[model samples]
Target: MNVMIFLLLSIICIGLIFIIHKYFGKEELYFLAIIYAIVALMMSFKTIKIFGIDINASIIFDSGIIFILYYFIRKYKYNESKKLMLSILICMLITSMFLITTSIMIPSLYDEFNFSYQNMVLDNLPTIIIYPLSLLITMSLSSYCFRQLKEEEDYRLIKTILTIIGITFIEVLIFIYFSYAFMIGFKKALIISLNSYLAKVILMIIFTIFLNIIFKVKKVKE
Candidate 1:
């Protein structure tokens, strides 16, 4: 299935996240989670063709989800919001990837790989809502942890969140660029691949800078 539209949309979403980050910085992790959902929703849809019943396992445009999920697991423990929230994101990312890959590898015994917007709406709407709630819970825990640690640093949560999200976005941009570069179908492939990587990287870096400023402001306030 041709997922060009979804790819375009995902890149746009990344850009939107950067803009949002510039204005509202403390919610960096929360915003990143939302961006992941939007991009993943499309990739998840495109991957449905390949994944079958486990359509949720697929990753469409890139692999940023891996880093976010991993960082969450490694950083926080059961009591920690960052750790728990990241764990949930990790589970969803993995589950979604599994669903997508299984569909691709296995013959379509269950669902079709249409990758329509309606399909994504039906499948991911609930998943998306669920993530934010989980994020909220995680955020609460993080607040507690920070208070306990009493870290003098300003925007402690914001910085950590931005760092995690930024790194993940960067990793994904790399994966997508490399994946496309190797898959030589024609000249357009290289052009598309290079453009995709550059756009995402630039957007992510911009968000990081904005996030840094947010942190600075928070520290000053403290």
Candidate 2:
């Protein structure tokens, strides 16, 4: 029953992302939204246990927060920090702020040992801050490598970024709905988290590719 439900939910999530990319794709971050969805799905399991809350719902909320963060950093350009609004540097700043805040708010969630406050401040605090920043760094690195190799003014960049953004929004909705609609426990959270990671990333990647093709057509008309 749980597996069936997950499969169904995965399909619905995929469809929703597709529609969002189609309609809201002013540029191409719509496709990149899927990457955010993929990351959320990956982290949803162990993290669901973090605050003793619904893992899926937390994923949705965190992703929403990231969106808002991304919006502000992009809109304000945060002290001329980025050449393009969607530059990798800006994305890092947005993602880092949220991750750092999340770390501060809910530290020591699943720690089996009682580390002292002093130790937490010196050791754990850096761990909390560094790990997430590493992820953002890796993503930024990937973007940089691509940018350096490709034509700087190419349109593909926009499409790719938009796809990632679309992935982010849809995953947020999915986790929010599932956490509310279903009663899930630790063991199930574990299993579903794995399923979500697998399904969401693979599906989003495929859908994002399709969205790119669609946008290519639209660009021609314009």
Candidate 3:
């Protein structure tokens, strides 16, 4: 069931990204990328079991953001992708600030929901801050790596696979260490980081292959 849901969400996310890019143009694609990043950050707090391994649910949306970055870097300029990354970073900073302030506010005596809201936000505050920071770092490194690989036309697929693995591993290490190491200990956090990297690489590979097929088909049609 977890595997099935993961695949379904991965397909939906990849499909929506290409569809928007196909019909809407880069401006809208940028908007969608920002939304994907923010949603991924918010969803990072929930873990789901896939093949008995625990992984964050946000991998689906994170894969979407990665595809957007890859698409822009492959088809447009690296600077354009940088613009998208900057936009996401700014938005995430604003979001974290808002969440922190809201979570710290005292609820009124008659309030029925504010406490729960505060608890949820404060509990996941580490993720709220860490997820985006990790994502931005990954985006920066991945974009640069992809840009370099762009010149290697003979090994596109191999380079793509390596880029995904390398970048996602970095992201998992940073996120898991800072977010979980203190609470769960270094050894447990390292184990979870490895699992998360595996899960992310799987999702990213699926998304990247699907995206390549879509663009190749469109190119053939054109």
In the range 5-112, model 3's lDDT, one tens digit per residue, is 778877788878777766667887888888887788777767677899977778789888888888888888877988988998898888889988987887888989
Prediction RMSDs, each to the true structure: 11.6, 12.1, 2.2
lDDT-better candidate, 2 vs 3: 3
What would the per-residue lDDT of candidate 1 be over residues 37-111, giving only the tens digit for each residue? 555544533322221222222232233333233323333443444554554456556655655555345344464
lDDT value for model 3: 0.81
User: How many clashes would you count in candidate 3?
Assistant: 0
Give the worst 10-residue stretch by lDDT in candidate 3: 213-222
- From the highest lDDT down, the ranking of the candidates is 3, 1, 2
Give the candidate order by descending TM-score: 3, 1, 2
lDDT of 1 at 113: 56
Q: Candidates' lDDT values, in order?
A: 0.42, 0.40, 0.81
Better of 1 and 2 by TM-score: 1
Best by lDDT: 3
lDDT at position 175, candidate 2: 45
TM-score of candidate 2 versus the correct structure, residues matched by position: 0.34
Q: How do all models score by TM-score?
A: 0.36, 0.34, 0.91
Which sections of candidate 1 miss by over 4 Å? 1-38, 41-89, 94-174, 178-187, 219-222
